[model samples]
Target: MTYIRTVLGDIEPADLGPTYAHEHLVIDGGRPVELYPDFDLSDVDRAVAELAPARDLGLACVVDAMPCSAGRNVRKLVEISRRSGVHVIAPSGLHLAKYYAADLWSERGSVDELAERFRADIEDGIDEHDYLGPVVERTEYLAGVMKIAGSEPSLTPRERRVYEAAASAHRTTGSPILTHCSEGLGALEQVRLLADHGVDPRHVTLSHTDKVIDRGYHREILATGAFVEYDQGFRWKAGVDNGTLTLLAWLFEDGYGDQLMLGMDAARQGYWTTYGGEPGMTFLLGEFAAAMRERGIGDDAQAALFVRNPARAYAFAPVAVTAG
Candidate 1:
């Protein structure tokens, strides 16, 4: 059976029905939040409450993109999953360089060292301390996916190190790689870099690329066989030509639906209803899906974006990892 790992445990791919491929459920205080206050999502009770309606809307699983010290709380994720009965896949790799401090362990550590930590988080368990303080108590909850981010136009040196470490961990643990493409730029470079590191593009998802409205850019990136996740559907105003909808229709028309996925990427507090925000977590399933249907996107195509694509993109490859 092909099983996908989650914060709670592994489950069959079929159980990953109707997933938001990239999101942030809990973001405790950290450098990311310190830099941007709206990024804080620490209240477990609030998160659980906000997720209930979405769960009722058939949001079966969520891939939490917050990773490590950038406010990734494994314990909180576990509790949220258990209480909400919604599967959550936590990330184990790294975020943008700005999320970490200068002279941090991630900045100075070697690729192998970072890879070991990431593998331990995936194959073993996530650090209970969230890699914030020195004290680390490994918990039973595990990370299900690996994450890495790159800046626009080009990847900085530090980001390349993160990519290498994430690729190594993915190779070792058979974990899926989800990446941040700043403003949808540099996705081609991100795909090429991962390819250079011997990572299969099919197992790597490039997120936030929908922000770039250029169809040519998307066509080039999709040619690499990498999965593209669009999360800007809620940004475009109603009665306007939403670029997200326009692009999605173009991609689906081009017959690239299988390599596409959808998410909210609602990392800000202003986006959650529990935090008193509009376009709550259920907006996608409620309003956006209805709009897509009105725009001629059939149920089968919606199924591919919300369900089948995630199952295939996030599934652990069958290749076995060898021990030393």
Candidate 2:
């Protein structure tokens, strides 16, 4: 049966209601924290408290974007899901190069070796040590998504290797893929690269494309059949044209609504209310949602954005089998 995997377990796609396609619920001590202290969101209580209001406001699921060996804590994700009554989908892949150490395993591991590590996370379980230690003790949680990233201007050699490995893992396990399009650049290249590697466009989602406000670029992306996640709705300064909303209006008018999804990508501590921040997680379901309505994004388009698109985008693809 087709299912959307969660930190707790797998669930029917219909059960994953109103999902945030990209988020960072946990960034426990890692290179990210060292470079930016705000990346630390290890406190489960704070995370639970932050998600409570949103959960009550009808937020049902969140695809946590922090992948393995880059501040991902599956145990915390499972706990927050249990406590907040919201399903959390954890990732089992790699992030940008800057987020990892200079000598990280991904820097040297062969594509096959890296694919095995990612596959283990999905099939066996997430490592209790987050793959930091040689001893890998997997917990009950299984990764729901395979995340890969590309640098701006183009994909780095290391990043290309990661994408190749991610595609291999996707082919074997049928897990959906999510990608980080740095500064909203190289999106077309990223899509083409994945397609070359044998990943289905429908099973992939490119994140942060909202950062680029070009309609032509987005049209090309959607034309490829991959989903685009817009998460910069709250970052636009007041008294300025909100590019995110503008893109939404344009795309919806052009009839590409089904190929779109929404998320906060709130990776910093200052983005959450419980962490003493402005426009908390509730911003998406409350303020931005209202804004979407005011901008002529009707109930049908809104439902597709928050519900239908996410269900299909995040659900695992069916693996094809051939008889010898």
Candidate 3:
């Protein structure tokens, strides 16, 4: 049977009910913290409390965007999953280069080295210390997805190496590759690079593209058969038309529901209601669902967006390559 890996363990695809394709549930300490203190999600109790309402609203799973060496705490993720009862799929890939120092593994390591580390995270276990220390102690929890990022307007040489490494990991492990499309640009190039690396377009998800509300741009990206994840539903300002909702309406009209996924991407604590944030974690199914239904997006479309699309987009590929 097809299965999706989670921090808790490997589970059947049927168990991934109502999944959020991209998010940041834990960010204890990292470059993000230094740049923005609000990115600190080191509190397990706070995260568990924040997800409570979303869980009650049928938030069965969340694909945590924080990967290894970028504030990805496997222990805390497992704890949150246990406490909140939300299936958590932790990433085994790299984040943007800014999240790490210049001499770190992602910058200095060879593609083979990077690929092997990712494979270990997928097949063996994620490093307990996020691979920052000399002695790497791995836990039982395994990573479920691969993540990579591209700079706005272009991909740097180092970013290319990271992309190749992520593709290699995906090739060996069959894990779906999630991406950070910087400011929603470079998606087409990211998809092209992954395709050239022999990574199936169907096994990719370009995130933050909701920041670009142009329906034509979305159509270009989705036409590649790669999923475009929308997580800016709550960030759009008032007075102007809700671009996120408007884009969703366009996607529904254009029959692109199957190629879409949804999430909060609430990397900062200020985005959580438990942390005095406004919309909180329940914004998608709570507020967005209501808005969608009113716009002719029925239950079928919602299911396709939140459930079926994630099941297919995040599911392991047809066959797993034996070596990294």
Candidate 4:
């Protein structure tokens, strides 16, 4: 039977209620922290504290989008989930090139080799050293999602390699694919590439696509049958036209609600109130739910965006086996 894998363990899709499709719950001491110190979300207590209010507001799950060698602390993720009483789905794949060092192993590994590492994280367990050290000591926590990122203008050679590996791992292990679309560009290209690599469109979700507001562009993306994650609901400036909300209305009116999902993508500590930030993690369920209702999005569409769509998009695809 298909199940939604969490950091603690797997659960029925119906139990995944009110999930944020993309989020950053931990970024402990990686290249991301070196470049942007605010990305250092190593404090387990603070993370539990930050998620407390959201959990109280019915936030049942969050997909931790940080992948390998980029400050993915699976142990801390498990601890946060245990303390906060929230299901957390960690990832196993790569992020943007800028998030890594110049001579990282991820840059040198072949597609098959990268796929092996990622598959191990899903089928076996996550490496305790986060795949940085010589010895790989995997813990009990397994990754639930395969994350791949593409650059703007087009996919770079390195990005393409990672995408191919992610597709391989997804095909073998049936883990759903979640991707990073830079500035919301390259989403259609990403979907097309993953499709070319034999990834089921129903099991793929392109993140940050709300950064682009054109209805036609979004329509083209939804036409391919891939899920689009919108995380900028709280980022738009006050008094200015809220492009994300407008795009949501357009897509919902056009009857593409099943392929749309929501997230906070709160990668920095400054985005959390426990770290003294505004809006906090509860904005999506509390404030944005009100905004969506005000825009005539209604209850069913909100459930699709937050509950039903994520339940389907994030669940493991059925892996096929041939009789030898």
Candidate 5:
């Protein structure tokens, strides 16, 4: 028997190849869009189209952090992966608490209940989609990681609940988690909480750290050996480039580039539509290379930033799947 072991249970880790560390297969605020009123791309169909470039670029996997009601497009995602020859990982925890509808949260009994839902997503499969609708069997749908996020200040109760559930899930099932922190405060606190609950900091990722640019915070978090994700490809309002340059330079100088991960975090239709610049991963990767080249960072450093570092942090073993 092929018994694959990880923080998240044992399974075949096939399908994931040349993966982007983060992405969204389908995200609908589910609100009426004032723009593109006639635009009708069902979540699955849209995911199929959005991923075309990744496939063409020889990207074999993408971890989609859509989570539960917000972007649990798993059925669609599986279909797309089968068609496009790409592996897609979906989130099974809470998104931003603000995105949590009050009626849903209030009606829910406690954080444990929410966690149970996540477990079901992982263990039982999302009910909205079945084989006919696009879902693979629950056993076939394995989440490589969980995901969570918080705001600028301290974490909210809802966010804390999500983290707690993530921690519990990690303990019970051994899945790692990726977090989104817009301002980067309380990341260390969250990391501590996860560690206290028995998760290794090495299995945690603090995303969007480039937004904060706090060197002290960066160093402290890295001390715990957690991965730092820099995902701001959008343009800046101040006419200055996002702090990626400064952050990268500092991390490189501090000898912490080995702990870094990169992504665009652009969940919109295109990269430039959300802001004003080139769109999608292709643009993001090119711009990052250009920026690094201008800064005299070596090609090996670039490969480490994109490849080796992420494999270490995320513990993705592409070879294991093929061997199986």
Candidate 6:
């Protein structure tokens, strides 16, 4: 009976249909200020347009995992959702440590304070008018998931601080966590730290696993009951060269298809023009289907990964029955 308040209005979690558990509406590498002199990269219209292809491919929802300070645009996400008729769940948590400028760190007050703010956003709302000014609004409109990352295997002191803040936020707001691991070193450690802080393992998602250590570590993470996202939608070098198919076949054979998911993770602006890939979510789903058929995979197995798996993992409406 969870409720979500979107720009369109409030809706139950059940109303969020077949969803891509991990996707980004907008993204910036947090490069130097001069990188984008115009700074027009914040455009929501362009981001929304990317999902149009997803709508055509039977996608009903996309979780925008882009956190603040990393090109997360909430207000624009609302507009895009309205236009695309695809639910967009935007994030409201912190990003990787390097992207955390000095000002944000100094102003965060403390982990406890940051956690309280995250709770207010989830339980109250982020708008000042709705919560009566920045102080109150700051703590309102909680995030559905907490996000964090580390560039290396061990958590740096600074990243540790952010991890504590995210853990605190999760503890106070009951929000799940999504991690953007670099080189896959600290992710398992981050997960252990979160669990040590009492965050549920089942609620966490280990994302950008394209580079995750081969079979052994992958299975180990799944054994912990965390959702593993294989977002290779943007890569179209060749069907046989792509690791996505291999990973999928392995997961299905090992009976872990229920925990698997796929996404494009498309970030570059002109990537769509290349690789025979379009800017919408539809391309990946359609490709996966085609890949399966080309490899002699059956519809039931394909359906489990494409439709049934995502809906079940994200708590969305079950996919509608359709003729083959």
lDDT of each: 0.90, 0.93, 0.90, 0.93, 0.63, 0.61
Model 5, position 109, has a per-residue lDDT of 41
lDDT for each residue of candidate 3 in 128-206, tens digit (9 for 90 to 100) = 8899999898898899899888999999988898889888888888889999999989999999999999899999999
Lowest summed lDDT over 10 consecutive residues: which window, candidate 1?
315-324
RMSD of every prediction: 1.2, 1.0, 1.5, 0.8, 5.9, 7.0
Per-model TM against the reference: 0.97, 0.98, 0.97, 0.99, 0.79, 0.80
lDDT tens readout by residue for model 2, 54-119: 998899999999998989999899999999999999999999989888887878899999999999
Least lDDT summed over 10 consecutive residues: which range in candidate 2? 99-108
Give a tens-digit lDDT track for model 4, residues 1-324. Answer: 899999899999998999999999999998999999999999999999999999888999999999999999999999999999999999999999999887888998999999999999999999999999989999988999998899898999999999999999999999999999999999988998889999979999999999998999999999999999999989999998888899999999898999999999999889999899878999999999998899999999999998999999999998999787
Candidate 5 residue lDDT tens string, 1-324: 322232134435442235566776556433212233222224565556656765676565566765665545555666766766666666677667555456654225476776676666555655454212345345446555778877667777767777888777666555667888867577888888788877788788888777776788899989998888877745454578558777888888998878887776756654533223346556545556677778876677776666666555555322212343
Q: Which of 1 and 5 is ahead in lDDT?
A: 1
When summed lDDT is taken over every stretch of 10 residues in candidate 5, the lowest stretch is: 31-40
Worst 10 residues of 4 by lDDT: 99-108
Let me know the TM-score candidate 3 reaches against the reference structure: 0.97
Q: What is the lDDT of residue 110 in candidate 6?
A: 77
**How far off is residue 181 in model 1, in Å?**
0.6
CA shift at 7, candidate 3, in angstroms?
1.0
Model 5 off-target regions past 4 Å?
1-17, 28-46, 105-107, 129-140, 237-242, 270-277, 316-324
Better-scoring candidate (TM-score), 3 or 6: 3
Worst 10 residues of 3 by lDDT: 315-324
**For model 1, what is the alpha-carbon lDDT of residue 89?**
97
lDDT of 1 by residue, 1-324 (tens): 567999889999987899999999999988988999998899999989999999999999999999878899988999999999999999998888888888878888988989999999988789988776778788988898998899988999988998999888877778899999998889999989988998899999999998999999898899899999999999987688889888889999888989999999999999999989978899889999998998888899999999999999999876674776
Total clashing residue pairs per candidate?
0, 0, 0, 0, 3, 11
Model 2: lDDT equals: 0.93
Error in Å for residue 224 of model 3? 1.0
